[model samples]
Target: MEYVAGNVANKAGVRLLMACLLAKLHNPLVDVRKPYTRIGGSDSFSGRKYDERYIADFINANALPCNSTSAFLTPAFRNRNAPLVMGLELEGRPPQLYTYVLELLDDVHNRRVEPENLLAEIIRWLLINRNEQQQRIESLLKTLRTTHGAIPLSSEAIVGLIEKHMSLKGTSRIPVLIVAAAYQAAGQYLLEMNLPLQAHNAADVQTGALGDVEITFVGDGKVVTSYEMKDRHVTRGDIDRALQKLEETRKRVDNYIFITTDRIDEQVQDYARSLYTQTDGIEFVILDCIGFLRHYLHLFHRVRTEFLEAYQSLLLAEPSSSVSQAVKEAFLSMRHATEAG
Candidate 1:
């Protein structure tokens, strides 16, 4: 597929920006994963270590040697499944390019590619195309400075600033917001209860491994709660897997909450209810995103300055202009009511 430059750049930028924002707003002292750092470098078997050596050796052993007159390699010949030597001479990619291309090939072998790799490629392309990446970063920093000055203590506006500069998607935007909100709420809860609380993602909760969030809280001698966020489309199989994961780490968490954005269909809700009923070790609470908004409407109001500003900015700046007026009005009114109190 032809990579659409604007879309690609936006997605890459937002992923990085969101990671940074979440870490800053929620877990300031914690080292959240950064984009574009070396991934798959954990062990020798990861193929990152072997890729260059293997490719070089293969090329030398099999490629036909010729004088410097030939074009380094033809695109078609380079991409073929031939021996490394033949492919290298045919592709004529320089040593640095080879590193990236080999990494790309290794991704194909493993059936997954890290977002950072794509980000690196996008940055490389941008640098080639009149140094756009650096320019965009500069633009983002400038926008951040201007917006913060206008709306001090505006978390929502700060998020919106990053979104505008980075071009984040609505789907990606909500998760980051939810995580930030959860962290803020949990932190306050900890202070009020005079105890620490832990948070974990689905992956760590599943493997009985403590997530960075969980470790940070527990190491501080605080009580920890585990929450798993679910989208409208989550399936029964997904729930089953999550349950299994929770069961694996039952001793670590004090309470388990399942947060969902979509209304649960009756059958699925029934299954969840039954499963929780039967399970003794884990306490389960299902929180609907819509209901949470209503019950905590006041909290929403308290946080309206930042959240509403973000919502409005997104509505105005997004390309489709498809966000509903009612949604915007409701949130704005909620914010206004909270501030009035």
Candidate 2:
């Protein structure tokens, strides 16, 4: 169950994982319990053949999001039966997922938790998560159909609209939406300013980019400005990490900005200020998330409607992991209400 839950987006070894578990539960003496079992009439004979077949068509054929693929090719999959081939031997997309699975199994093995009770609780959690997500999607679909409120026109109205989304607890990546939206809607304006915007990196993706948002020059593709986002307060330690990343990447940027939802630390601000001269004119600064959006909307007041459209587009386009289904609907609902036209 830990393995099932942890391997949310990356489902390489997952199908075979639960399949083997089910096989064991159905028949304790089944050889399919081991991933590499070559029992003549086991999986290859009983189930579908071809280890290299894709699981995507199965998911589509079933009309569900379930990912059921062969784990035989996955690194460390053959190590499943071995004592040493625990989590690290499973999947590499998420490094800790296999470890998390081991911890869950260990709890059961140690009698720390009754397998049945834990299974029941896990089922409950998964159900609730699924139900809530479905409810949100249904609600969003409802909103997407109707024109909710007047289109956001003013900077203040737009700020209030965004504030509604930010107040949505557990949607940490929502902050990035505003930053992305600003750049997205102001694409023309940014081009005029000679700061071409790049696609905002997904919260979960690592694109080897310095920040969540990077603006590069038109000709050279060198990042002119980099924006790192934090849902919490800025810290000196965070600054140290930013500095280290700069050092590691050996990339120079004219401006490096930290956008955060929480209050700025005076000491941290002072430290960030010091980086300007210390790094020979590379500006390192932190700005309030909402404040930055507010400024951008006002500065490009003519494109206020475009900004709202861009934000809505972002909310819906983002993956469920980055922006929850509920958060996406909440924004739609708020937008529908805030409109006067």
Give a tens-digit lDDT track for model 1, residues 60-172: 34321111111112242222333222124323333344333434434423447443455355444433432343344345444444444343434444333333322323332
Residue 224, candidate 2: C-alpha displacement in angstroms: 1.0
* Strongest candidate by lDDT: 2
- Candidate 1 local distance difference test against the native: 0.38
Candidate 2's residue-wise lDDT over 37-130, tens digit each?
A: 4444443222122233433354334332233334444564543333323343454667666565556555644567654565555445545655
So what's the TM-score on candidate 2?
Answer: 0.63
Clashing pairs in 2: 87-98, 148-336, 149-336, 149-339, 150-339, 150-340
Q: lDDT for model 2, on a 0 to 1 scale? A: 0.63
Off by over 4 Å in 1: 1-47, 50-138, 144-173, 192-223, 250-252, 275-277, 290-297, 303-341
